[model samples]
Target: MSDIPLEHVHREPDSDTGNAVFVLHGRGADEQDLLPVADRLPGDRHIVSFRAPDRLRGGYTWYDLDLSGGGLESSQPDPDGFRRSLDMVAESIDAAVDAYDLDSDSLGLLGFSQGAITSLSLVLERPDTFAWVAAHHGYLAESHADRSPDGIEGKPVFVAAGAADQIIPASRSEAAAEGMREAGADVTFGTFEGGHGIGPDELEAVQAFVEEHD
Candidate 1:
């Protein structure tokens, strides 16, 4: 994975509940970008904000999905490159879980845009690594089909999208939700009033979703 360590922001759960939230940042952003979302969520949840492995310009990226150009294939994943990056991100998650002594069954991933795409890839790659995944304004890269995790049946999932989002169109969002459903995730998809970003109301829904799943 480029032999570079992905930086991360961590927030211990306010209560000793042993639950945690892993936050994945969007393109051109670092771990700090999503830390505030963690804060806005339930305080009792331990939170992790992870930077992407590749540093393009001043921020980071999960894969090459050209967020800058908005073209069809600017930053699209080249199978090999994406595999390496995904492996490192998964390894980070494993280490984070072990370091915190957290239960994998109670773990969740929260990502936005590029982060969301990475989150979906992570869940698909591991099969049963997380209890829940919250993807905000993100979609799976092409050709990645959905499948059920071996052991974690009924795995919960939350997806949020902006109706006017020009970056990752609403159609892609629906496709993502459908794909997750086909893969057997207990999916909850919501659309907001804005575009390309998460709003306060969306965060509230995310908060409620996590609490309910936990």
Candidate 2:
């Protein structure tokens, strides 16, 4: 769908373990933003982090935002733009698996904020693509919430929300967790004391989820 190529940073594990993890960065962040977290996660899994295609301000964004009314909300995402980016991410994952000769069965996704939104949407849209998912400080976009939940049944999902998050309120995050649970996913949901950001506790939980699922 999208003709634009996906740009990324790939890190190979010390040994070939036939597994891989893909990292998706928050809004206004680049591919390198999540590289450190990839290193912290357990296992010898190839790590790949993709840069969002759209440039905004000094950084990149997965989708445009509507900061109207003094709150953060996704503008009606351009359908073509969203589809193109999603297609690129899917293609990139296929390419990575093939290039690294990695096991497709063990692939995982970790994303924060807008990146987390994309991760959840992708996994919901194409549930078979990821073995597990960790979405931090993100909620399911309203546009993508009507899909059948059957595809994600039994899938492992981790949702970390910031209790004081002004950008994405806890109520929204809780709703996202409920949505995942209703989809029959084995969801692990937690909330930190901070606001709209990840911390050490969140990281530890993510590591545990990855270890348990992978």
lDDT of candidate 2 over 44-113, digit per residue (tens): 8888889998887777888766445355643334566667777878888888778768798899999998
The Cα local distance difference test for each model comes to 0.78, 0.83
lDDT of 1 by residue, 110-150 (tens): 89988888888888777577878999998767646545566
Ten-residue stretch with the least lDDT total in model 2: 69-78
lDDT of 1 at 39: 83
lDDT: worst 10-residue window of model 1: 66-75
Model 1 compared with the native: what TM-score?
A: 0.88
* lDDT value, residue 127 of candidate 1: 56
